[model samples]
Target chain A: MTKNKNNILSTENLAIGYAQKKQQKVIASGINFAIKKGTLNAVIGKNGIGKSTLLRTLSKVQKPLEGTLFINKKNSNAYQHLELAKTISLVLTERVPESQLTVFELIALGRQPYTNWIDSLSKKDLQKIQWAITATNLETLQNNRCSELSDGQMQRVLIARALSQDTEIIVLDEPTAHLDMHQTITIFELLKQLTKTTKKTIIISTHEINLATKMCDELIVLSENKIYTGTTAALIQQNAFENLFASKIVKFDRALQQFVIHSQTF
Target chain B: MKQKPYLKHFILLSVLLFIFFLLNISQGSVSIPFKDIFTTLIGNTDVKDSWQTIVLDFRLPKAITAIFVGSGLSICGLLMQTLFRNPLAGPFVLGISSGASLGVALLILGSSVFGGFFLTNSISNWSLAIAASLGAFLVLFAVIMAANQLRNTMSILIVGLMFGSLTGAVIAVLAYFSEATQIQQYLFWSFGSLGNLSWSEMRVFGSIYLVGMFACLSVIKPLNSLLLGENYAKSLGINIKKSRIIVLVITSLLTGVITAFSGPIAFIGLAVPHLAKMLFTTSNHKILIPASAIIGGMVLLICDSIAQLPTSEFTIPINAITSLFGAPIVIWLLLRKKKITI
Candidate 1:
């Protein structure tokens, strides 16, 4: 078991699942990992391969069927709702508002846990909000309405919201899902800066495995019913990515740093 | 970054409410002196008993009821809009108001069905309140159940509208078979009126509204988190299920109480919240909720005053007046831009 006092999150023999009235469908089992403070990790897998599900489970967005997740070495289930909010922040990959909320106002929502019933912002809150806006390079867009923003700008605004949350850990689902090629690379670079500057654990899910393999400090690969995770160079050495694609048509090329499909003519 | 000028907007709205109150007290059927009205309001009046009756018993309760119902309806609308993530969502859109109308109809027409339940005329009002709350709660419950299965806000809004139309048809059927006098009473209730509330009824309504507003305030954090969508809210340590339940209960209580005391007043719920948002330029419920309440109270005060005018021999229905004030703003909004989908 990998145990560190500074670990922000650690999972033990986790079985992620969806709970209904009478049954639960476990998506994956025997999941184990530890996310240290000041680390950037990317969870990557094929479409419908449960990357999002595992990210959600780790973030406590849903219940785990069996095993336990510990935040700061305490059972995640033990934290009060408000207390949990103060500890971890999350960014979802969905369009949410019809209100003409500006980027600043949307970012201010990250301060909800600290605000009163009226959701007032204090001087410190404003300072933090300004820091987030500046961190995301969204100073000019502070007054612009979220509805008027491009998808790339909206994604940055979302990240700024998480930054304003001031939590030790942030889990985002496909934060770069809708961005263009340039925007995706910029976001990953921003994530790298966030990890080093904020000293916070940042976990995100993405389908851009090649980019993540280059930019992220560590990679979590979900395949079949197992998870393989380690530093990028270490994972490459272990051949963990070789079995990710279909056995018949594709092979992972370690030297060329890409996936190649060999013909079956022979 | 500097926050929006929320305080200035709030103060402006307060001033507007004060002005509207003055206007509301000015335009009754018998035009009392503004001095007398102002004195009476500030509790230094020695006016004649007849004028006092016209001012206090007749006009005061009516005016107060308008403000109370407006506050309740607008807050309810704001909550529904955020909860469903659709600005088009309103009190009636969710079927809560229609549900209350149905309950009032049943109480009026089904007295015989409940003849052995130790009921009396005095108890009928309480019974009506209970029935209205239940009706609203039932619809709210249905919506909550549907939300669990369907995540789309548009689909949930459609379900709510369908529930509204269904309940309206039921009320219409009950009205059809009732006695003519009962039908007239039902029709009057359906058209909406603030003048129907007595001072005693106002106390009951005031208490319910206070409780509902408190419940609404308690969920401000969760509600704000919701502005980012459910999964994000959940990650922020919000219990999405519990928050949704609290919002539903508060919304039902507010809508149910207003509809019970003042009938299913329209347009205020649908329009006032938007007016508040336009004025403030922010969607944070912390400001929007109170802002909407104030604007809603002002609009209803104006509409109720216009409703009391001696136009010919008949006073216009409060609902009609509210529609006149509300529908134009909505039409203007629709014609102006196609950017905001809700």
Candidate 2:
């Protein structure tokens, strides 16, 4: 693969997995991909297929079992921990620990990497937090405690927090995992708009392949013991969605660009 | 406008704490008048010598201890609850107190089995403090190691509980082998006392508590990030392992020192942080840390005042007073809120 100057993140022969003492479990290997700047991308795979693991590795929260990852034309390993935080922010699916933090306070936490040792927000930090809240449409709920928000609203708060981080790249793990159909679509649209307006690369691992394929500029499909990375339409032409779920009951309809029931047995 | 309620609560609590501090010093065993107490505090020779001695030497040190123990344990509790992300977590939940208790127990009880030299010779308070700190540090080291090895918070909690029970069993065995006098001494130590601290001990305790408070201040940012979860905290550039170690060290120092001096005073560490969170209505540690410390100090002052039994010459054990008062508030808060969060 050619190294594109526009690429914000890329992996070469990457192997992602967990390693214990004298034992290694390779979840996926020989992976190669590049994510360009200002693009919305999605990693879609079946349940328990290492989508989260892949995201964790890319965000540098976990170490890749093998191979190299490059961010902004430099080896990812060379970036200091604080520098990496400024380059890539992440939103995970884990429940926020029980907190009475208001939406504003929670979003301001995103400015942590930029804040001084005391973690006080300056005028510039406050402006960034306000922008994140406004962008995520959380203006009205700024004072409400995080515990009181709906799952969809909470997800947005998490996104706003990532926005406050003000990183060049934002990665989310199943950002819409527990949302309704409408909320999920809204989140996808929000992510797309964020990428376009902020010119920040946004990558999300999601199970909503149909929506992702429709909205995302790029799709990374994990299937058939391999990784497929390309434009959504190009991946569709390559029939990358065919083996997403190796089951007879559900099938990906290339024509309709959605999944359909193969049989009326149910 | 957004910070109005928090500021109001802080002012209210601070005023209450001041009143409680005055009440705590004024109505001790001899029941000195508030005016006399004030005069004594400001270096006025008009106050009676006995009143001055009681106020300056006895009641003052006890009140100061109350403040240190209250603030230190509450902040430590807040740190633990956030680190474990469990509502039930507290300063003692990680067995730091148990470790301290074990140390005290060994000194008091083990002397019987080992020829009674240390106890008969009158072991110094410094030795006891050092032993308790060492025990607490050992447990803290073990917990940190387990935390690094296992990512599960619940497992770490269980491991801590196991260490507590294990220490408890050792204490029990020591009790079994000890004479009744040694057992009585050990029992008295277990009862917890805030008034026994000398002015010199208070200075040492105060400085250590200050160090722990400073540590708490340094980690407030990371602690706030942790409210979202470890993954989110890590994404925010928090070194989770480092934060965990710092929290443990601070907690151990606070709990160990307090327990060494006061014999594992309970309830304040477990209850004060929740009270602060409820009153402030925010989990931002910038507010919660100081708020919890103030409230904790106030609560302990109230408890200490009641334990003094102002009207009567007889006083009650502070541990009993704290449990009786604090346990109910915790229960009421839990029931009223119907949910508890870190």
Candidate 3:
């Protein structure tokens, strides 16, 4: 719990969006937030919101439209591409192209930043890969081809790949976007455990607002053309969830910690 | 533990390659005995003079050509497949061979159109090789330009295909008006001749191929990271643009050089990588690159041996022979895999 006192990621007056040659489209502006070490943070919003753009900007996969973003108290842009890779790992939503690669080979690729030019894994590198596989409960599936894995298992393997990266933070986009409720909960629980046990910050953008409120250490709500950042309890007390949707058909039920549809008297 | 399987496969492939190498030299038109072939290879004077000339002069360079062309094309195919993340990608998929053919076609057919007497056999083989390289380089340059302008790999692939068809159309037109003898020469070149290279040409081929192979070795890490997808690869600290350019350059060098010498030999580039993947059951390029090279050499040697038709003096064209053997394996693999994800 003491690790939460240290900030691992922070953004100030950040503008997120796309920029053409002469025109710029800003999704969200004046966003200020800090992510603590060893915490699981979820960014949740309705569809077409700028959750993904914000994540991409923070990760430096795409440049921010305006303002400053910092990682480990240093300007994110100041870190070289290779240095940034060592500090943070990302899991994208895209399916891995099918290769004849086994789960073990796939995970070992996480050591690329440290591996030799020929990609030979050292003893420590191999041990880290082993630890990642074991931590993710992928020992039995290590020799299986990635193409053979189910959706949930593949997601876990990707998480293990990030773990093997041995970075200070992990960023995932829609980690459970295509999963069943059970699988979604499993992934959320995994992230929660990973953040606590490994003392690594984890950030994810998801549409599972109810689950995020229940399990996340902090929530960043992108709604109403603004960014809301706070602990789950503080955000709820601030009535942030009420403004998340139109509140016409579905409404947030504070007491039950979930959303409910209004019953129509026909 | 992982190294053990790859090592075993490597050793198996090396053995097959050695066997094929010996077969390639010994099973030509004259069918020299193994002992005579070996003795002649080691500079002994015990063998018949004709057999010595046959083995050292003819068979040696031909077998060496087969090895380099096979390994070069297959490695280029592996690089292309990984770069594009498309299973159908090959060394020539980017129109490199078509470009080479267009060059050769222009030189051979163009000369006849400009001057009727030029077809009396004044043009040298060196000019054809240069023209082919120039043509391949031009296409490669265009592809690289398009690749820089386009971020999508599929678009680059489409542009390459279009370049190929465009070159093919030009070659068709050139072939239409050329004299019969000129057309026959171009046809012969297009059919692919692995046996015609002199020692000097083989030296050039060998050096370029070795350099390309070394370049491939340097990029194994990036290539393996790329299997996940380019975005994931970039996240892993791979410079995607740099890797793509390096892969394209190496692929272009290998495909262009071999096409210059061998005339766009078919199917080995496309099929041998798949063969290596299925046999090895791993997409790790560290293993696949060498495996494909060895398997490619063996496949080409086998094809070349069959092309020789040991009983007759007339040998078949290597291009036709490769398609004969390689196309069916590719088709079968496609049918068997059902999904072309790789």
Candidate 4:
């Protein structure tokens, strides 16, 4: 629980959930974790187990039920809205709203928090947008409308948008939700590459536990009414993922080093 | 920046709007020369007295009203569309017009409640605007509340339609209880006209229109961010609740005031934004706002000119011509593009 100066974002005993009808609906609670600089981290859990909730709380999208969140060693609540935006960005799983925006235009919208009143792009913002397009390999699609892109391509566009924000930390919610296997790997690899190249901390809540294990520097596992935060190897050694599911259909296999079907038919 | 081509498109729209302004001003029975119209607009007194009176007092105010109603409603359409992120979102589609209609209907038809004070000529104009705005504001507030409750944008459209029907039912009940002249007064307002605004009314209307338009300008950045979806907009540091309130308030202001002054004109608000989006081929509100405003003004001008063409005893309600001309163009654009994208 020691606060590291290098820790870009950290949470203390965070209770993550939603408020329903003026009552706290605690989906998950008593969670504590910290994310260091320039690391690729993933939050993995069974469906509806509050991985998204925890990520949202950690990113300050939703308020914590009972905890403190710090960014850059400062209480998250102390920073201004735009100041926090410059610190953390998000890649959402929500449907991309219909628009006449081109791939380039869509990504450029990410710089809104940094722009002037009219939202015009500065030279630095323009350069970052270009770099994002090149980084995610969306250069050819820059002129095409976002509506015309395939699901996989749109996911990359979302990442590029987060990149152009130029935040120190980026959080994504199931970026590869609707992609094919190849596209999924491409997204994971792109995320890892982005962290290495830009030195930005990335925390994605994903269902691809195996892919996360293979690519991420750390994993935050939400399961068994407990929160486990550590490197993949360390979590594996500690059996952090044994109770990820209620029915116990899948288990962590030592030989495979990934969650696999323990029974032929469950 | 990929702004050069879009700038050219904006210039082209502006030029077309200017030409249509001349064409519209040159219409009507006396048929003033385009040159005389220009001179009259420039404050030159050399023009004939009759021409000056007709141009300045009648056609000029009507033309300005046409431009205001057209551009104002279309801007409201763009705001609603972006706020809800639904292509079908517009003042009329979302029942904001119905709200205004119900307000005006209540004022005109249900004036018995206020002992016919609402029908007084001297005070009716201001009263009508206030009533329309209040109605538009209430309906808008309800619609926004409903939209906020629902996460799915399409459901917001459905809620808007439901509100439209609800207001229609209320107006019908008011009509059933009213005298014939009251019904006619309400009917006249409902038919929609761009030619009835007086100079005094326009002075007030113009100021309100400018206020709403400037409010629209102030929110362009937030509207641009909203195109990606609200959660992402929030992440981009947009105060979603504040922007939502601003958009809804201006929408109600423009929609209510335009409906009050011009009698609930339709189609311009719904069709012009699509036309602008297609012409500019981008969704940046910075361009779409101006593009839609100009195109809305031009389209309404063309519709107004067409309405004046018969020149006989028979008169065409502007509401009819707008839909007759506008609906087909939107359909053709959708079919030609083979998509219904915003």
Candidate 5:
């Protein structure tokens, strides 16, 4: 149960799962982690290891099954939905349901918290949206409908939406899902650049251990028994990732800092 | 955003709506001249008494009713499309019209249940309207309750459809046991109308239409947010439950009130929003709401004009004209675009 003053977001004994028939279906429990400001963090784990659950819980999309979540050293529950929205934003795995929206309009929607009731974008709102479009390198595609864009371009639109929100923390779930290697590496590099340039904290849940270890400043690896949070070098030194796979399929190579097929497989 | 293209389209549509308004009033059974309509529309007594009565008492209200029904149902359709995130959704998708139908069916065909003596001779239009409203609200209430219990918004769409089916089944049962005269009366109600409204009914219909329009305008921000999907909408601080209810209630209110006054007029609500989407090539509800309203009124006015069949005594039912004529035009527009999307 840690709530450090310097951390932008932290958890205290958090438990996460859906409530089925009034019974808590706990997927992960006794979880604890804190993210500092302007840092790029990756929550990496095996399939169904509750990476999305942790991100969703932290973004306040769902209530924690137990314990507390703090945003800026304050109890998260004390913040209003709109207030919290001004502090944190999300890019989720769900596709934009309506495909007819233009790229500019879609990104402009991120200013929902700041726009007036009629949702007309003010000068400041337009500037932020333009900045996000430029940041995501989507200026050429701003006029195109989202349905017309490729998956990689669409992913950037989603990120632009979060960027336009101008929040201190951006949480992305599978930001590179369904994307090619070049696109995945581009997204990872973009996120790193964003955190460095804008001083915004970014947390992403991903299966790309190589990219996580290479690009992210910190890693929150979800294991079955407990959660581990540390710098990649520190976690590697602690051997915190040795049992993450719990499988014989692939082994983590210390020198390469990536997982590779064992030579004995033949 | 530079909305120049649609701004031009709006202006053009507004001008066309005005022409259609005049055209709708002139082409009815009496065939008044455009000058007399202009005169009668303003405070002029120079027109003949017969022309004045036909234009003022008959054609004017019917034309106004056409505009209200068209715009109201179209707005309802727009809201439904955004709410459900399904292009096929329309004003009656939630079955509120069927609820209205069941109410009329129970009143006209439910003689077995309500004792024919009291309601048989004196089923005033007011009572009929009241019954339709009650039936619509009953379904509306049920849908709202169901929406609250269900976490998924798409599930609410299913719940609304289920309510439609449930009420539809009841109406079918009533039609099954009813006499030919009663069934025919209910059938006439279903065919829909625009010319039968009195001034008092217009006042009631117009007020409810305005209220629904205002509520629809109020939800523009949330509606825009909703285009991304619910999770993104929630992240943007939209109260999902509140926005959902407001959308449902406004859609129900507009759809129900229109059905109450004019019967279950179909096709326009479903087709007009698509027309707006096609014309504008944009999904921003800020433009969509008003554009649908204008195009809705224009389409219905045109259809109403065709139904009246200038220089003929026989009149076609508005519903037959709406689908018979409107469908091909929408299909043509879609075909020309070589694509379709909400």
Candidate 6:
């Protein structure tokens, strides 16, 4: 009933892993971070650096091996499952429906948590669903089947789904994983706009470190068996953002504002 | 102000069902006049014994059985489609129907193994029902086990297909060694007929279907979330394991009973669900499930009527009628669209 101040999600010395495993072997242990509500945060790391694993753990899709994750200063485990769903909505990089599901119908799925056994969508629910579609610039596509949308459009549809869920914390795992450069920029801009307009904490993992560095308010970098979190400027100041990738082949050339793979030797 | 187009289709289908009911009552081998059929339904016909037997024993039970079997198979098909998240999934895909047939066959052929108590028993119907249910449930159990071991949908589907084929092989083996008379009886049953049931036999079918439908209604919420994926459903407070178990049980029950009474009437379960989805573009099970039930009932009734149209003097096998409509739809779906996955 009462909302906590500032911190939407905080991990304190947390170790995350699969629940089926008996022992808590940390993916990246002793990690501490707080995702403040209404902030647009980008989590950047090299592929296979456990960025997705960390995201899943923070979203409570998987259990942490050790330590605690708190929502509003209360233990996350204290929240009921549906309560958690109402608080934190997740968007995976999975495929959308290939069948003919109109955008309106797809977005309405977000209200499923509030629906009864009959899966009825009330007028209020419809209003929220329409709002999500409009916020994601999906008005024209509302009548179109998801199968008919472009990859970028489909990605927005998925985001609209999370928005319709009406959660305070929205977590997206590599939301821009399947898009062209133009589409990627479109999705990122939309993500930034959504964070500001909806005032929801947005945490997303991306491999596009350069774009994320320029666009995101805060950046969480996972590298070399450790995790680092700070604003993009602060991370650059601490020189911790430069070591995200191996330096031998490609180096982060801050002057150029991008990674430059070795070319002089060739 | 928005009206679902399918609502019109449903109403039209209902009208057609009424027409079929009338035709079925009047067009039997002992062609009762339309006037006589109406009088008979109104409990008149002067309480004549022969006419009463024709109405109650010959026509009424057969027509009701057609409606029930059609609706039941279609609902079972709809449930499988949603649960497996595959358009091709059906009651027999998971081997439940074959399992039922195997159980029924065992009773007809292997009953002598159970001694005289089984042979002279008045409780044979219940025993046959139980055996069929167990057989279907065994296949369901195997499918669930395979699902546990294999997480991929395609693999689970392949496993289910193999299980069905294996059940078919067992049935064929059993059929091979059975007495000629028993085989002949089973073969006739295999062709499928709604005419076999009397009014008393419908009691069990009605009760089982009611229970299955109720179970399905209770699960609409979980099923909607499941369309997103198991992980997504779990995130939404649904116990995915429990929901899966309940759905599997309900599908098995409906499929088993229909197969037990009417034999495995194909395509109604497989095709009707897809038809329901096409008519109603929403993925929400609330609309899809019930819509599939009614549409399924209508399609089956139509098919049953067609089966009865062997020049009106003889009945064609129901399976033959189903394959006529079913096989082409499957080919079109495969050629036109990629398989629907969750």
Instruction: Please report the candidate that would top TM-score against the real structure.
Output: 5
Residue-wise C-alpha lDDT for candidate 5, range A1-266, written one tens digit per residue: 35456699998889999878878989999877889999999999999989998899999999999999989988999989799899999999987775578899889899999988888778899899999999999989999988889999999999999999999999999999999999999999999999999999999999888889989999998888778889999999988788899877777889888887765658
Candidate 2's residue-wise lDDT over A1-266, tens digit each?
Answer: 53888998999989999998899999999999999999999999998889999999999999999999999989999988799999999998888877777888888889999889988778899899899999999999998888889999999999998998999999999999989999999999999999999999999999888888889999999986778999877987888888889987889887787888878776
Candidate 4 to truth, TM: 0.93
Model 2 chain A: lowest-lDDT 10 consecutive positions:
A93-102
Q: Per-residue alpha-carbon lDDT of model 3 for A1-266, expressed as tens digits? A: 21234989998889999998899998889988999989999999988788898888888899888999989888888898789889999999888988777889889889999988888889999999999999989999998988899999999999999999999999999999789999999999989998889999999999888889889999999997567888988987888888788767778989887877786863
Index of the highest-lDDT prediction = 5
Question: Candidate 6: misplaced stretches above 4 Å?
Answer: A1-5, A19-26, A256-258, A264-266, B1-5, B45-48, B111-126, B141-166, B310-313, B329-342
- What's each prediction's TM-score? 0.89, 0.96, 0.96, 0.93, 0.97, 0.91
Clashing residue pairs, backbone N/CA/C < 3 A, model 5: none
Please give the C-alpha DockQ score of model 1.
0.49
* DockQ of all predictions against the true structure, Cα-based: 0.49, 0.64, 0.64, 0.65, 0.72, 0.46
Interface RMSD of 2: 2.3
Model 4 chain B, poorest ten-residue lDDT window? Answer: B114-123
Instruction: Point to the candidate with the largest DockQ.
Output: 5
Interface RMSD of each: 2.9, 2.3, 1.8, 1.6, 1.5, 3.4
lDDT (tens digit, per residue) of candidate 3 on B1-342: 144356777887899899989988988767678998988888899889988888988999999999999999999988889888888899998999999999999889987776753454666767778889999999999999999988788898999999999999999998888888989989999999898778888888889988998999988888889899988899999998888888999999999999998888989988899888887777878788899999999999999999989768899999999998788877898788755545
Q: Isolated chain A: TM-score per model?
A: 0.95, 0.98, 0.95, 0.96, 0.96, 0.93
Q: On residues A140-179, what C-alpha lDDT tens digit does candidate 4 reach at each position? A: 9999988889999999999999999999999999999989
For model 6, residues B56-105, the per-residue Cα lDDT tens digits are: 77788888877788777877777777777777788778788878877777
lDDT digits (tens) for residues B302-334 of candidate 1: 888777774334688999989986798777875
lDDT of 6 at B81: 75
- In candidate 4, stretches whose alpha carbon ends up further than 4 angstroms from where it belongs are A246-249, B1-4, B33-35, B112-127, B137-163, B310-313
True contacts kept of each: 0.63, 0.72, 0.66, 0.66, 0.70, 0.38
Cα lDDT tens digits for candidate 5, B1-53: 32445667878889999999988888866666788789889979988999998
lDDT of 4 at A170: 95
